[model samples]
Target: MKQANSGALVVFGLVLIAGLGGALLARGALYLGMHEGDTLHLLDMALRMGLHGQWPHLDFMTPIGILAIAPIAGLVAMGLGIGTAILWAQVLVALVLLLPLVRMAGSRFGGLWSYVMLGYGVVLCLALVHGLANPAPSVSMHYNRWAWAIVYVVLPLALLPDRGRARPYLDGALIGLGVGALVLIKVTYAAALGPGILVALLVRREWRVLVVAVVAGCAVLAVMTALGGSGFWVAYLTDLLTVAQSETRPAPGGIDFADAVAGPANMPSSILALAVVVLLRMTGRKAEGLALLVLAPGLFYVTWQNFGNDPQWLLLLGAAVFALLRTDQPDSRHAGRLHDAMKIAGVAALALTASSAVNIAYSPIRHLFAEAGNTVPLLSALAGQDDIRVAEKRLYKVDAGVPLDGVGQPFAAYHDRADRKELSRLKGEVLPACELSTGYNAMFETIAADLEAQGHAGSAVLTADLLGSLWMFGDLKPLKGGAPWYYGGAPGLAAADLVVVPLCPTTEKSRATILAALEKSGWRFDELRRTDVYILLRPVRP
Candidate 1:
């Protein structure tokens, strides 16, 4: 009891430090890197839910589980500005996971490992940058980070023997809650880790834990269903399937699954994981070894499927190595040699993944020091959100590229070899093969202002591009049934009053895909207005 209590105290101290740092970040403006588009997507969804009393899958189309944005939305609902809400949401997640972290870490981990378990928990919850080592501090895919923290908490509880007396109910509840949280945050993580977790409990004969996890998961589902109504499940699944079947983003960021698993950058981590599995098996811990083996493929899939495909799994793998090292299996043979090998593997795993872990840990500090003079407010019309800023160059510089394929152009000579194809024809109007590379912040604000000027201030817009975020900038309503970020299908089309087609879209493929879907659906539009920037059309509703 003393040990657990002392360890819990250490966790609180670490969490308090992170909490103070998060408050500082909330006070200062945030400067994001390489993910303004994703940031905007999150901000838009959060605002839709917060300001409009809306819900995902009911009011909008998205595969992302509500828990991803609900905490931030909850903060926004409580009258905090968007910028502060985002920062504080991280702190809130860390605080929410405190009980599980303390319980799991204190009961299972010893000395340095106990501190490590709790410390990483705080990092995962309060991290300003989504961890991959290329840290410039941005709040994007933060749910993934939160899910990982829950994974860390649950993993040790399921895998290791408790240092103290067994408390299956407490352990079971934590496991169940963690898994349920994962399901509600992002089902992909839950799907990936589910089998391994179940297998671990089954192999270890932790039937109580297994039953409790399932019941708790179902309870979470029941609670959400009651809140969002029974239709929520069907709509949520539909949105997920739509994204899964999307032709535009078959694998996020065009990642090669094989490469992500065994490529030069990730090969070492893969090898280290396999070695640990073999070492564990040889030392009379086949169940632990087997669970890790099952976890390996899921880990790889998640790394590849996520945008940027950062190998954040390495930290988890490192934790696994240390946890196994701390355990004693009396029936083991060749224990000395294999245990030494395990120590080497643990060190190697942590060393390889150290940069990413360090980067995530330091992000709040990095965000606190971002220069304000060189940046402008992220949203132009959001009155009190000046605390979220973007670099002037990223926000205001308009740049687009169209392939050179004219009668007299140099590329015309090699047209056959160029693999050139005209994009999509929208209502018999051919869109050029053009892409808007920068100035998205400007694009949304400009279109919103223009639409408001033309007496379309409060209309719901469905952009024929990758994003439909004009509502964030001016007097427009977020489409009642829109996808914050397009993932195939005409999600918000029927609910939209107008369609804004940018001349140079952020993603040409998305533009072409959306237009093709519209054409197949036989949707017709009346040209309301046209300008150098966009074509505004009113959909002829059935």
Candidate 2:
């Protein structure tokens, strides 16, 4: 018992060091400005709940689950400023994910190989940092990254050597918890893993495990619905069924079997899966090998559907390699051949993993190293600020008090506000800056001033862009039913007395549709203000 406890402590310490080191590296490489669409939306909802006692209504059109938002809410409730809370939460989650990988590696491969496995896991995670640290408004955002990590963690437990001897109930409960958590994050993504998990359990004849997983998954759904309110189910189901069917949302294209197997993102996983098959065959574990073969296609489909080029999917490959190599079987007549084959396969997978990490993280890593000297002062100056600002022609600042900047403003603003604090301190801040093509800050300032001039202060206002930023920055009331883009423009626009539009080509079609709707409803709109990039409109006497 004492020896086992000591071994566990040593493994924990090694994992802790590796996880923290990798997290720090990721922070340096990939951490920068917060993403507007998803990250900001989560932060906005959490802030609203914490600061003003408001719960996000189900009427809003978004795929983000309650679990995703809950962490930020809890952090903010603890009196941590939103910016600090978000950064710390992201770092902590990354570290927690490393724990299981470390344990599995230590148990299976003692000595330096345990640390090698840890390095492999970190590299896999580094590939994902691009999306997690600096997300975009695409369908696969941070939640998708979380789903990928969860799948990596859960899938390997089946291949662990001690599975047969483990407590049936404990093992079942753990599997159930993993699957349930994934479901709570995103059901569609979970769908990809659910079938494979069910099949694996069936192949193993682990009926207890299957039953526990189903019951736990259902309980999770029920609890989530209850916490999010009765309307949560209605809104969640409606959005899932409707928005997913909408033509405007980009859908994954079909891939030929060859491309699916050979795509950059899919290649490593394919190779690793093949390696697992060979390893299992040599060890005479036919049942496990067959179960893995069944799982390979589903996992590939999930990766292909999300983003085929992202190296993050390679983590699945790493998980497969770790699982197959870690078994505790004694040496056999085939052991020499098996060890040689495993080494070659493992080395190839690691090389690919490293290449992918470099491909995805190169820019951020370069930027971080290039500006390392200025990081401390920059962070000190901007700490606790979340409002977006531009400085030194090299960075776009967020008011969250973090002195981080990115390459450019990817979205437009609905109104221009001029009361921004122009500081000399920002003039020399060295960071990666985001160039704004259109004068969004100026446009937003003008809109805010114009709205106040028109006696529209405190009134619910609708916007086609920057809905959360506008409300939070201008101290305006939340638009009833949430942002039009999320809730469908017609309903949110109908509930507001004023609507702000940014007339970019990307928005032209949606703008035209909204205008036609207003005309059909016998509502006349007067243009309140116009800029090169934005136009503010108000309902006028019909």
How far is each candidate from the true structure, as Cα RMSD in Å?
2.1, 10.3
Tell me how far the alpha carbon of residue 530 in candidate 2 is from the true structure, in angstroms, after superposition.
Answer: 3.4
Clashes of each: 0, 24
Q: Give the poorly placed runs of model 2, Cα more than 4 Å off.
A: 1-39, 52-59, 91-128, 131-140, 163-165, 252-283, 305-313, 325-339, 355-446, 465-468, 483-491, 505-526, 539-542
Rate residue 505 of model 2 by lDDT: 18
Q: Note the Cα lDDT for every prediction shown.
A: 0.81, 0.52
The candidate that wins on TM-score is 1
lDDT of 1 at 251: 87
lDDT of 1: 0.81
Give per-residue CA lDDT, model 2, range 1-542, as digits (tens): 01123255346645654454444344322233322334345545666665655554464455556555556567777877665455445445556656655444454344454554454444333332443223211212545655665665566554444423444454555566667777666666577767667777787787776787677667777787777777777776766665465433444334554576786646766877777676776666666777777777766666555534343545445544544563344567667677667666666666666654554334323323333333221122223534222232223231212113222433324113333222211113222212233333343445566667767778667665433335554536666565424423344555677777654412333444444455566667777776654567786646
Q: Each candidate's TM vs. the true structure?
A: 0.95, 0.70
Report the number of backbone clashes for model 1. Answer: 0
Query: Cα lDDT for residue 403, model 2?
Result: 19
